[model samples]
Target: MNTRDLLNRRAPVRRAPASNPAMFLFGALLCAAAVAVTYWAFVRTTTGQLADESAWREAEGAMPGTKLPVLQFLDSLPLLSLFIAGAVVLAVTIKRRRLAPAVIALGTFAAANVSSQLLKRFFFDRPDRGVVTLDFNSLPSGHTTLAASAAAVVFLLASPRWRPAVAAVGGSYAVLAGAATFINLWHRPADVVASFLVVGTWTLIGGLIMLRVTPDWNYWPPGGRGRGTAPVFAAMCWIPGLLALVISVGCYLYATKSMTALGSSEAMLLYFWSGLGLIIGVGYVLSALACWLFSIQAGDQDR
Candidate 1:
């Protein structure tokens, strides 16, 4: 056999089940749980409102004399760019017969965004929950939702070989977009977090739908050139996520005493930065989780 033929013969083909009922059910459960938790946290609990308000106040000019036009720019990222990128990625990566999955994945973005708006307007009611804030419920910031949903859809459209890289880049973008909301005082930490969860839940459901439709298209080849990208992407995600968690914990520990008094400006600033770090950490962790959840195996290809 030729060298190319020899390699193909030696390389193992990955395989996945025709339908993953467990993953689909798990995704559904996760989506429901996220919605419940978000609603309970933002609308049902007084402590939730208090914590949210404190975070909001700290984020909104906690340092004083600081202006964040750049944050504003990040918060105002255009949705059209997201749509265009999704279209381009789908065009390049998806096969003609596999177009249905891509279309469903892209539609997930719109569904997720609309859900956030509807939840904010109709379902989540902030009726004098003891925390001082605006009248409207803002548990899930619309901007953060849009950013995170965009990231999630991109991940869904990516091939298994490219998923890790997409996850890393997309997670970073989502985290920055979330942090920008906090920095600009446009949303509380909880708001951004809820948005992430919302996108994650929807992405899970959408991914399962894709997997169900394109069971044969999602696999990795042994000894493939693209094999390296997955592990590299995982490393990138874990390192930053773990570091951010450590930093957030340390900051919280350092500021604990001052937080009781709610008096020290330094403490508040520390908390603010720590909260931002936590957002980054959580975004990446969830992105990584989503990648894991959507992973499916298929028969080996001829190539």
Candidate 2:
């Protein structure tokens, strides 16, 4: 070939997207740390122990007939219903004909629940500790685990374009279900928080797997397809989380001081509600973060 022909014979090169696998790995590690810290606080720390028992005692009062029926109904939702719904969502929303995302998404639910149960049964024990709380371990509530895990599955199954809305709505559902448990005295605040962390951990791991197995379809475009309200959803998470943190800290301090001075007073009741709000806020925050994390661009295809 002549020199002119040689200069024109350049080969096209395909470059990878800006997304880094290390980011997902870091997210997974961060989630794991959250779970570990939450578990340790509940099981080992004096303040954590006192706070949990106080919240439980404050929440364990008699409930009205109206609220009892509602909470009981929420608690009685069948596991099969979640599986069926998850299957349907997976069938409908998945644009690409890939099995890895679906299988890993569903597996996340199982992993989270099984891990929670195993931890509750064998790993952690709630000591008597001279308190009136139950001796049995209930750090990660089984009911909350079911709710949060189900939400994670739905979030995973949703299309990348719809994930923000799914994260907001589904996170709200999980939060409400967890709140119902606290309102009905089914679990303490720490129990629900631990359940959230467990679900977050498994969901992050599942998200990393999805990124690896289906990088092409698992990301947002450069201009972002101009779809989804992830930023709005993230704002929803941050606003409530900040407010709840302030309220919960105040209530926690009050409860700690009042146990000796006022005993089981209105302060304890305030503490219970505030702690419950904190759990819900944290749940939403984690869900929103996961939604954003999973939306990272997978490859240069969309760009």
Candidate 3:
């Protein structure tokens, strides 16, 4: 080869994007801890059981007019639906030449749903908390798992710049599904929270593997400058996420400290909204965290 040609070919190699191993590892552990705490607090303790039961009963009061449509949406998503969604996502990823991230995201989805079922059926059980509930345990809702894991998969496989918008829209759908289950009395508040934590845990684990194998494309625009989606969607997620959490806390504390006599309808409504708040808060907060983490870890893609 000519000397000029050789020199032209000797350009500097760009570094791959950075990954957040610590965030992925400890974030998963934190999710697991949250799941355990949710189960124990809402399933094992008498007060927790009472509160959970109250919320469930209040949800039962929801008219069929309100609950029927939600049931329809939930029923439309059978096991086969998951497979179809998975296949479509896989095909899209492979088309874009992102085989590794696709596999990890899909695996995360499957693992989360399976774990939730196993925990409900074989492992975790409600031990006679004496709150007048049903005989079988149903902690960690199946419906919520299906919905949330589906959302998480899309979020994981998306480009970092698009994650915030995806998170807002997709996370809202998951929360809506979770809330639907709660409203229809299919599951308690604790059950939905457990599913959220389960999805979060699996997502972080998948993210750990995804970062190791595919770091080059896991990046976003650093500032709100040029050709990026405005942080509008991120604000959409953050505002509701923080508001729901604070209001949920207030609902719980108010219920605890209320001068009203026990079991008043008003107090029951408080507990109900509190449970719903947990659903919305945990779901959106996870989305917001994803937005922030990818922005921080992936660095400026434009550079």
Candidate 4:
């Protein structure tokens, strides 16, 4: 068959109009920032003092008063659950004739897993406490990352008609996973925050990639035209990107005890808010720029 005939036969084979190389580059830069943050939070904290001793004791004291089935489940199958969930999502997507979404979800899961492992290995050292701790590499909690990544992918693949509902479900899962990890004393609050950052950034990148592969899929706005330029695509991505940033900042502030503990001498409240404001501000500006650039490109193309 001629090239044109093959192209006609597989009309959906073309790269997603939304998957701009520039976006991929932007995503990479964000991932790098996440990695740096993870290193600083996990690695740097581990060095100063094996605070795990006090942290463990505190955890034990706190554990007696709490009943957490979800935490128990998380401790029992930290990494395993994510893989199983990813497989199930992939299977369901295939059955529904939405193989691309499934593939995108699974692929993102795999990439996140590998990245977590690499980070763990690079910063290998046994936890200063917790005899029952899984293995080396405490920074950027893998369990949390898996949960967030899977939840984000599920949100992306959900039908536009059901996107909000699906996003709610995914958000619930992500929260449960984070709580489970924290209550079980498996990961520090900072580790959980970093996980959200890294996994979330990658998930957005994956969604953008999927957009490129299927521009007509209308992954946003619940029933809008799929074939559009970068601006529309950027707008679709911006929602989740902003959400991720908001969640990350909230997690960081809460985990670091910056929001609570008012009227205390140790209140570095201003510092926390300042840092969070800067990150959020930069993220918003970048997203706006992406949208503007895409809009300009679309306009020029029309002309």
Model 4 deviation from the true structure expressed as Cα RMSD, one decimal place:
8.8
Candidate 2 regions with alpha-carbon error over 4 angstroms: 1-17, 61-66, 80-85, 93-96, 221-223, 257-263, 297-303
Q: Which run of 10 residues does model 3 get worst, by summed lDDT? A: 221-230
lDDT of 1 by residue, 1-303 (tens): 798898768554455544566766687677668767866875678765655565566676664544457555663575543765577556755455556766777778888889888888887777787656787778788888878887777777777777778888889888878887887787877778778878887887787777777765566554444655666677788888888878876765666655532324444566676677778877888876665555433233434
Better of 2 and 3 by lDDT: 3
What are the per-model C-alpha RMSD values against the true structure? Answer: 4.2, 4.7, 3.2, 8.8
Poorest lDDT segment (10 consecutive residues) of candidate 2: 294-303
Best by lDDT: 3
The C-alpha lDDT values of all candidates are 0.71, 0.72, 0.79, 0.53
Taking all chains together, the TM-score of candidate 2 against the true structure is 0.84
Best by TM-score: 3
Instruction: Summarize candidate 4's per-residue lDDT along 49-128 as a digit string, tens digits.
Output: 22222232344335445646756678665566566566668666777777776778678877877787676667545444
TM-score versus the correct structure, for each prediction: 0.82, 0.84, 0.88, 0.57
lDDT of 1 at 32: 60
Q: List the residue pairs that clash in candidate 1.
A: 15-297, 16-297, 16-298
lDDT of 4: 0.53
- Candidate ranking under TM-score, highest first, comes to 3, 2, 1, 4
Off by over 4 Å in 4: 1-24, 45-57, 67-70, 76-92, 95-98, 123-136, 219-303
